[model samples]
Target: MPLPTTLVWLPETVSTDEEAFLLAAHFLGESLDGLSLSRDPLGKPYPARQGHSIPCLHISNTHDGGQRLLLAAKHENLVGVGLDMVYLPRMRSPYKNRAYLHRLAARFMAHVEFERFQRAAQQDDEEALRRRVAAHFSLMEAASKALGTGLKIGAFMGHSASLPLSALGALQIEPWVQLFFDDLAKTRLVTLKAQRWEAYWGSDDTYLISAVFLFGNEQSKQALQLDYP
Candidate 1:
């Protein structure tokens, strides 16, 4: 019945996350005084001011060399939300070249997952393989961003050895199946270490994008010593 709210920050117009945040505030007609910019221990952006009158805001931003700077905000203190946009061309070699993808998968993906990739490569489904690999990394990066850990969890690379047996279920998706809508876009809920993570990922002709989020207390909270006035 109503039009969906839309916000687009053209790459030429916005270059940094902080600027993007301010642009969003302006777009919503909210005053600078009402919400101040802030970042957490991990240097992720969020709103510093909060209370009954002021809103609690959380933000996450990502960009790749002259590409788009994306930020996400939520009124709820839902752990954190992370989003990333990657220019597929920048990931070219691995996308178009099976040899490159294999080398990459061997070093980054889980052993079984890599085997799946090998099987897919053998089938000569280059485009599907390309999108799947791109979506996979994008999703993982988004998850790490949401967790405020960056890629220290190693994203998808070398994770086969470190992940728990149950966590490996996240990799069970068959290679031939499109991970995205019509094999181009998708929303995935993942369970790991007894916790759930929310993610949406897709790729088009030009770019790969993903957004990941962890809900309140879904994962154990780290103790923070906040000082009060």
Candidate 2:
């Protein structure tokens, strides 16, 4: 089955806000020369096309030198689109810090949720482990912000309604990443299709980086399947 979708994971080579923007524009079928994007006077990225309609779509996410770009069309419309990306390593400082673990757990937990996560971490449950891995998706909040609607409106928790960030400990944030994405997939604002990608660099392999691309829609399963590889 061919699904309607397009996604790209940016490696460290194209490392910069400008490069990230261009890559995203490319996914959504926009030329860098055609659109003028500047850090708005208000510090937001707005299209230079003031009076013209910007299609109520287009988004980008960048973190730790990686970017995820998604290109999607409206529900069979083929015009509307949106995208998002994030870098995984930047969200936490120095892996395996006990204090950092406690701090994140406290911030993410909602009483009962926190305790369950703690038990999972303590018991070494595989399911709990994955949820903890997805905690890295917390950075998606910032990715969503880059997409247009800041974190205030697009909560990462909302994206990953199943596995909350606060539930897991400091091992990994992949679970939250998965959940956050699932949430976006369910939204009507823009039919979203996303992909997860990763890369490694440095002699010591100091970076464990991942990114997500949320596009407009995958009218066909063929395109959507591309998300896996």
Candidate 3:
């Protein structure tokens, strides 16, 4: 972890797909000429600076109809990093099919958190509540990916949407996740930051972008910004 800075940037666009690519270079501080360096085979960003060996992870995502893209990155042998951006328009009623969003939320929440969210759902509009719940679930999924294991194995598969509140509560510091944090601490890499912003596309479409950065000794002192014409 020689370099200790994590930079994140988001841009508004009329083209949802393009926004994903644009944010990648902007966050990496590279020109179009360095485009190839921003993504690995798995789409994670490689650390900048030639010959500088450091572990780096990055992710970018956009919802099916979203006008904005969310980007994330970390250095110092950072583990998995996942970012998900969904258009508010795409959220549907989960009660009709409590599979996708419901399952995701169930896997991410602690017992108390799940109960609180569930109570809120009972009183709120079903569609709106689904969006909120999905957003939260996605955030946790992103955070979990940043710590490694992604959302494919372990905690993810072990838990389902019907998980008990008490069981969800126990997820705060699971042994596997704890071990990841321990490794970061042992290596003196212990910085975490999150950002949220709204982006406009073509004056008609808009979406929100949330980003998280994880690093340790090598961190930037200033917020990263990139200009897109």
Candidate 4:
């Protein structure tokens, strides 16, 4: 029926987000004709047509806006996917400013990770740090998007005694959370690790983009299907 799983296409140059998504739908449909696109309650794209159920195709599009755009799609039963793009901050960009970057990182990155960021900032070269943060930011966006919930800022609410369902949220890198969360903790962690979730990146001189995909587990499917509207 549909093409094999992990069918991704990053077509070039479409003027607007609407244009990009339209291209993505038609591109996927062409491979599996008569198939159209639809959004689930949480806005993740999936192939569909009237009178038929949503296909197992899990599609993701880059929500980061820039001069360029990308879309990734999977069929044949992959459960989750996320595509994200980040504009590499220019030499004069605020992101390249050492102090600013660290401040921003401290807010969004895990304390340990931010400490790592601080160390990188100590180097004479700022470019490496810029690229590192951009890449990490790309992973964060992909993680949230892949989860199909965007970012769950609220998942950090309440106390650690009964930690929230941390897995559904992404980018919960608050410095405080690090102490309460660890490898052996019973509560799901909000961190995105390279081992469990795969984040693949591609970058040009100006932009960095990523596609995160997974066969995914039943727990993830249930979270995505029932958690968000």
Candidate 5:
């Protein structure tokens, strides 16, 4: 079966994290009141029942500007999953300025990754560069979240070796997506497979959405699937 992932777009007036949950409950055809939810020590939400875990389902959520998206995977054999969405505006103007951009690259990017961003930025116009950087950041964040480490340990691990600047410039999803699996193998941070989806909302709004599945091994490349709109 395909990955049970779902995306929900919320209007500006009603945008909230809770809406994602509501959509999940709707997608599952269950009333929100019937589901028991709990958070781990790190504050990630998961499904629970009578203080026991629900092993069959995994969920992750993210929001950007006025839009919210969720990923719900029903896996009889898989483990954990993570989702992330980044707003295009988050990486625009002052945020993408030289000083701020350099700081962000230093914080989350390895030296080689930073170099690639630099090269790409020099070649592309400001808007294109901003979108690429935002998407990269979103993917990294999604991977980290899938590992249950958030940005603490996962972000610092070396990813540039797998996700080179050349892949980003190639503008091909397959090559770019492969880098996530490659990074997982090289770092062994967590055994997971990742896939990303990009969406354009309004005339001016764009988002980079990513998901990662955990406990996935070599065969995961074949088992994992992504649904994009």
Candidate 6:
């Protein structure tokens, strides 16, 4: 069967990451009604029942400053899904410092990504550059999570080194991502709508959250249908 097309979002009300995860699980259990939840050896959550092979319902959650987001899906065979969220920093924030940004790029981004960030920083507004970098990192984190390898050992790590930014660029399309699932974990570029909500500091803030759904043995170009605003 095709992967689940529905993507649900819960409001931000939790104080910590653990609380956010619990809220997401609660929402998922309620959404599925009778489905029971279980965790694998690695701590990934899924739906399960007795006398039958448990169907894989990939779940990923992220939180920042009391805001939480979750992405979930049930893929027919077995597929991996990942989710990540980030707070978009304002231009006056620490992230806007070139040195700090470069440090992050060196630590987590590939050469190509660093170049892209440099170019964007030179030509675009600080806010735009921040969003671009945050979005890229979120996607990379999501893909890594989907592979159950995290960033340290997944596609972000290339040839026993950090994965190249060009590799991530190649995954901007569904087919390429699917083809390189073993390495890239099916990460594709999709519309990420910025969300605005009141922060714990009693001020309005913006966030950028992303998800990578559908990584598996099968090769398909189909992209998940996500509706967010």
In the range 106-175, model 2's lDDT, one tens digit per residue, is 5654454455556657755443333343343333333343333333222432332223333321222323
Q: Give the distance in Å from residue 149's predicted Cα in candidate 1 to where it truly belongs.
A: 0.8
Tens digit of per-residue lDDT, candidate 1, span 22-65: 67666655566655666655555665544222333456666664
RMSD of each: 10.2, 9.2, 10.9, 8.8, 7.3, 9.5
Question: TM-score, each model?
Answer: 0.64, 0.43, 0.46, 0.61, 0.65, 0.60
Candidate 6 per-residue lDDT over residues 1-229, each given as its tens digit: 5545334455544454434444554654534334455655455555554423245555666666456666666655445666777776543486466566567656666564565557556764655555555655667766555544454444435333223333342123211231122233233221111111001111124777666654443333443323211
Poorly placed runs, candidate 1 (over 4 Å): 1-7, 26-31, 50-56, 75-77, 93-96, 112-124, 153-195, 217-229
Judged by whole-model lDDT over C-alpha atoms, candidate 4 comes out at 0.49
Model 3: runs farther than 4 Å from truth?
1-23, 26-35, 38-44, 48-59, 66-82, 93-104, 120-122, 153-209, 217-229
Against the reference, the lDDT scores of all candidates come to 0.51, 0.38, 0.40, 0.49, 0.54, 0.48
Worst 10 residues of 1 by lDDT: 178-187
Please tell me which model should have the higher TM-score, number 1 or number 3.
1
Q: What is the lDDT of residue 104 in candidate 5?
A: 65
The full ranking of all candidates by TM-score, starting with the best, is: 5, 1, 4, 6, 3, 2
What ranking of all candidate models by lDDT puts the best one first? 5, 1, 4, 6, 3, 2
lDDT of 5 by residue, 1-229 (tens): 4455555555555454555565675786645655666777666677765667677677777776767667766665556666778777667766567666657655666555566567657655666656556656666666555555455444555333333321121122233352233333334343333222221211246666766666544434443222111
| Cα deviation of 5, candidate 6, in Å | 4.1
- Poorest 10 consecutive residues of model 5 by lDDT? 165-174
Quick one: best lDDT, which candidate? 5
Candidate 3 lDDT over 1-229, as tens digits, reads 2433333434453344444554564656645443333443333344344534235535545444623344545454344444545555455434544455556566666555565566556655655555556555545444443433234345545323122222211121211111112232222222333221111111112333333344332243322221111
Give the runs in model 2 whose Cα sits over 4 Å from its true position: 1-19, 31-33, 38-42, 46-53, 65-100, 108-113, 119-122, 125-229
Candidate closest to the true structure, highest TM-score: 5
